[model samples]
Target: MPHFYFHTENGDCIRDDQGEDLPDVEAAREEAVTVLGEILRYRGAAFWETASFSVIVTDADGRTVVSVTARASDAAPEGWTLQETGE
Candidate 1:
């Protein structure tokens, strides 16, 4: 098992000082997606008009494994296409 940090970036930095012990990176990815969905829902649909959101998952050694993001505008990052997927 390994500890992973789920840091959030919306308007400011949310440092994940307390991490969780997960079996591997795949588990972390699932957790991150679940967390990100919660955050987005909490913010409500109105918030998306103003800001893009992301959950950055990092390992114990501080290496980013994956970044799950929700785009807020027509101008999405290059190489990334915006798909309207609702859960």
Candidate 2:
């Protein structure tokens, strides 16, 4: 097993001092996505201010293993109405 650190950056860098032990890089990648989703789920309102967010995963040796990013854009014209998509 290997330890991976999940650092995040929205506007400022947040270092992950406590890392997680997983099987391999693949697992770390999945964890990164989960972490990213959790962040958005909990702090989604304030997230729009940054316009972009990322989860940077690094191994114990300080090597980058995976990186996950999300970007939001709201470029609607004035008085734009939401159309119902017949989903």
Candidate 3:
């Protein structure tokens, strides 16, 4: 197994000081997608404030293995809003 680090960039650079041990790069990629989804689900509104969001995964040697990014393609439509009922 190899250790992997997942660093994120939205408005600020967040580094994963403590990495995880994974089987391979493919597993890390899947983890990145799941991590991004959780961030979006909990912080969707704040996330959109930034131009883009990204997850840069690096291996134990600090070499980038995989990357995932999401960007806002267009401006939000008029009257567009997100409401949460604490669900």
Candidate 4:
């Protein structure tokens, strides 16, 4: 068992002082996705675009094993316009 830490970066750092014991890097990557998914559920769709952040997974010795970065891709069809509602 190896200890893994998840560190979040979005103009600032959120360190995971208490790490989890994951079997390998693959498991750590999966855990990071699940963690980010839960965050997106609360923050909503635009959070990924606005924040442009990464979920960094590190080993016990602080060696980065994987990084998950997200950014919005505006793939709207041509001539599509966003409907604005009165505030």
CA lDDT, candidate 4, residue 49: 56
Q: Looking at model 2, how many pairs of residues clash?
A: 0
C-alpha lDDT of all candidate models, in order? 0.87, 0.93, 0.89, 0.82
Most lDDT-accurate candidate:
2
Q: Write the per-residue lDDT of candidate 3 for residues 1-87, one digit (tens) a residue.
A: 899999999989899999999999899999999888887888788776996788999998999999898777587768989887885
How many clashing pairs per prediction, in order?
Answer: 0, 0, 0, 0
Clashing pairs in 2: none
Please give, for residues 1-87, the per-residue lDDT of candidate 1 as tens digits. 899999998877689999899999999999999988898889857446647778999999999998898767657567987789998
Error of 3 at 10 (Å): 0.3
Q: In model 3, which regions exceed 4 Å deviation? A: 75-87
Which number leads on TM-score? 2
**What overall lDDT, based on C-alpha atoms, would model 4 receive against the true structure?**
0.82
Tens-place lDDT per residue, model 2, 10-81, is 999899999999998999999999999999999898689998889999999999889999988878657889
How far does residue 3 in candidate 2 sit from its true spot (Å)? 0.6
Tell me the deviation in Å of residue 73 in model 4: 4.4
Candidate 3, TM-score vs. the true structure?
Answer: 0.81
List pairs with backbone clashes in candidate 3: none
